[model samples]
Target: MNPSSDDTMHTLLIRPKAGRLLFSLLCSLLFTLPAHAQEADTARVKELQGVEVVGRHVTGKLRHDSLGGMSLDLSFLDDMPRIAGNADPIRYTQLLPSVQTSSELDAGLYVQGCDNAHNGVSINGVQLYDIQHILGIFSVFNPSHYSRLQFAGSAFTASAANRLGGFIDMQRPDTLAGRVKGELSVGLISSQGTLRLPLGGKSELILSGRGAYINLLYGRWLKVEESAIRYSFCDANVTWLYRPDARNTLWLDFYGGNDRMDYQEDGENYDARLGWGNRMVSMNWEWKRRGLTLRQTAYMTRYGNRFSIERPDFRLRMPSGITDYGYRLSLRRGRWTAGTDWTLHSIRPQQPETEGERQTTTLSATRRHSTEGSLWADCRFAVARNMELLGGLRANVYTIRRSAFFSADPVLSLLWTSGYGQFRLTANVKHQYLFRTGLSAVNLPTDFWLPADERLRPQYAYGLSAEYRTDLIPGRLQLSAGLYYKRLCHQTEYIGTPFELIYGDYDYRKNLISGKGENYGLDLMIEKRTGRLTGWMSYSLGRALRRYPGRFSGTFPAGHERIHEFNAVATWKAGRRWSFGATLVWAGGTPFTPPSYFYLQNGNLLSQFGDYNSGRLSTYIRLDVSATCRIKVHGGRESGLNFSVYNANCRHNDLFWRLKFNNGQYYYAPLRPLPKKLPFLPSINYYIKF
Candidate 1:
């Protein structure tokens, strides 16, 4: 078949077929019923009582823990205000004081001065590389499938290694041992469904899926031309749990998601297409006794993206992907825990295929295969009646590009409980061997991954933190304050622009540079945990500086650094059926590079940049509001309707600025700045439960 025909087949036939198969499988699992339905229902009541007890214990742990992490329940997210009515975990986490991004349009997370690549995100113990669906607009995680979400700023647990900045972990719900239950939801951007079924006495299944229909709505109702633009995404999840006895349990999990975007310009004779997705499978087993507990897990994960461009005379295709196979084992006795993890990584950074009448060739810049392993041990002990101590150690080994690298990390923490309050001190060291680079300012699918080699060494960091927390009114109000400092080495940064790489050279390594960074900050938060009116207020003051000896000797602010940040969130329960929420945010301007001057060279205008990150964008401010109403449905069921308004005050927060040059002159007129931003948007959603 011809090239155009082949492309059409893949887009129209293959994708739809795969999507149908996934949807069918999920539906079958969700609707399946047990042979002895009446018998199962009789036992479900007793099982539900036990589940409630376990839930209470988990909630208490979150409320009283001194680890300095944020814990959120899925129910809380349903009532929180969001953009476009999309309930995303990452977006909710970004509202915290310790996290910052370049702008509202950027999905990349900058945690405690560390870049997004330095942080790790996991779902059910499996790592994820690409987490966004439409560039920076929405996240791939389905809120309907998650039970709890947690985030740690600096000092993470030993189980989460190979990262320098921080980690985010999401947990799926356990087996629902009660009667069958399901929920269906419809919104402006997407639709989702969830079901939980009890198979028998010891087995249970849960299934969920979400898909976007924006393209269909636009084409049919809005009368949009089909050939102009197109975009869509879908994701599905399945989990099964079996508990044969009181001491042993087993679980199986599967997840798959995909996204695609296509754009065409008739006047310019240009076409561009981008596609990316992730798939994961895992199995876990656990056994517990009086003093000993053991757990094992095995999993496989894949992430990939493809970009293509075609014109009258030129054609190009670029593909990149990463695959991982991993296993983990852990044991716990009393206050001590030990674990080991082994993983094999297969990475294809960038492979370009060019076809034309004059030249046809396929080339790659960096393709790598590697193995990574880690062993860790940790312990917690009570030193006295009021004092406690915790310590851990980890050893890591990485084999990359025919070479091996090894490192050791240590963590320590001290806690003291007094009559007035609690105090904590922590110290840790971390190391990483993997990195990602992107040409666009936003977190797009075009980002590529690379491993450490002779020229590019691994990255490491050292961090220290101290905090004090107190309760003002026992269960009504609380306050926490912390101070932290971190030093990072061998951090990677992209120095060349996207146009330079496309028009000049495709060698990405030659255009990359490494540097060192330092960050110091203070954080303060005041929270009201339980009441009719509940919420939190937080403020952060920080500075992040970087130095690259090879390129420049002077230090400059990091691209994502903000000098000051403040956030306030509140929710009010007006009555049994009415609830309202509001969020307000303000932050300092982000730093950028400004042009020094313009010059004429051979009838072409060229510009030079001044010191790195010397100019600043405008200050950012935004407010969001939401309201929810509960209604009674048939068969004793419940339903809800949610309405939200983003940018309620109509603030024109700048996404980015464009630089304009005057008529063919090198230095004759002032440069004009054009701003692009998102305006006020309103959205609504409805959900029914049975």
Candidate 2:
């Protein structure tokens, strides 16, 4: 049971004689995983001729999990192994195992219990609270017309409602049949293109765009010392569909994103140009009379981030914004599914000059309003014919206005399946009123940004999960294991109140406090998706701890608590037209604080963090490689020539947290230095379709 398939080993170093790139890598290595249904309704009409639905992956209507816990499927990408923009589906879920990718195309992913606003993102289904387009490292949907991807951890199901450890769902793509497919790309780290058309008939039209420049490719290493940084970003999407017939349907979605950063510093060593962004719009509808089946959706979102930091002497300006909207309805009855959703939020953080400010300076800003609601039910029955049963339930209501707070969260689940795999038990009581702000002292953004409290009182969690799936060999061994325990009542962070004083870059004075936190985890998977050498090996063991009591390192162990994670990937098929792939990652040392000691206040220098993740750094592994070559510039087969090589071990590995005032000795800054090793980077690409 070791199929480990991916990029299905296509080898054709340089073809000429025919054999068509070795039959397109054996039809993309005939995908492996997710087939059992009596090997798909009786081995496909006894072998083709009048049956269709095997565009790879052993046949598909789409639904996969070759032992890759927390499922995601877009027909499972024809047979996997396709990475070249559109955040490669969040970089293939960062090769799983508690996910990790703080930057380098960041969506701030550091999942192993959670943090980064505590996981929650959705697309076609709505709900997308700050999916980030930049300034937090990439992600804001643009996977060139995706079509379903889901991830849920921390006891979720009951239709996954309001906050707690994990959730990501994306859906879009199914343009009334086909025709008009597109893909255009350029790279240094950013560039994308997608288009699909087919309107009339049942209705359809799709468009996508993406952009990034980091000052046009690093802009000479951000100018160091002189302290110059430049950034740029963008995202756009449009979708429309109205199927007047065929049961009934209506859908419309528009998305937007923006990010800008310009900086200069030398003498006063500080200047600024900053901007933040997010915008969303959505609508969904569907109906199937009689037997009953319905779906209705709604969405609206807005987010703004503004900043100003200068220094002739010193100056700061901060502006923040937030807006949210929601609605939901779902009914299926039969397999069962009933739903509901309501979300409302408003947040504005404003900074009103901190008087004479200096002693190492620290400023303050905050404004907020909140409301959250949820109702859920989802089910799938059938206890025999191979086994099946999936349950659900959800209820959440949270609010905070000025200082009067409120919260109520409830969630539950049950899963059990036969077909050689599947077992589940989940429970949740999640909640999170609001949080995110503060990290200057080198965390950059030149100090100024706060918002948490319209009375932020909603931090609840009582989770438990037990999941298992197995198949160590029938069509190839695939395995998944999950165990989680969550117990958290309240958690928020940021402290220093004395009137919100934040003197000098290091003067960190006065009050800036917020409290509560906890997380627990364990998830593992082993995959070999079929023949010609496949890929996948993962591991994750987690814990996130935090409890603030007033300040000065009140309680710690939450900076994306990481305690061992490993990943391995491989690809082969070097015969017909040449194909190659490789990946390796290992983690175990993520918790940092090296600023030693400092004191100055008023003008800033009050950093004294000796605890909280106590310091650990020395475990990270890297190795990446890709090679593709196929010849055929006509009709189908995607018209040849594609080559890629990234970090083939350029292995500089360190992207921690930096702040080492050098000789001036502000020391305690380090993040972005994985130079323990390096080498290998080559790229070449070409693809044409007509």
lDDT of each: 0.76, 0.60
Off by over 4 Å in 2: 1-93, 97-107, 110-115, 119-152, 156-163, 167-308, 311-314, 317-411, 415-419, 425-427, 437-476, 479-526, 529-534, 537-568, 571-690
lDDT for each residue of candidate 2 in 534-573, tens digit (9 for 90 to 100): 6668788877777777463466777656677778766666
Superposed model 1: Cα runs more than 4 Å off: 1-64, 218-229, 264-269, 354-361, 364-366, 597-606, 633-636, 659-678
Question: Residue by residue across 302-389, what tens digits does model 1's lDDT show?
Answer: 9999998887877878899899999999999998999999999999987667776656666854568889999999898999977888
Please give each candidate's TM-score. Answer: 0.85, 0.29
- For every candidate, C-alpha RMSD to the true structure in Å: 15.2, 23.8
**Candidate 2 lDDT for residue 105:** 29
Strongest candidate by lDDT: 1
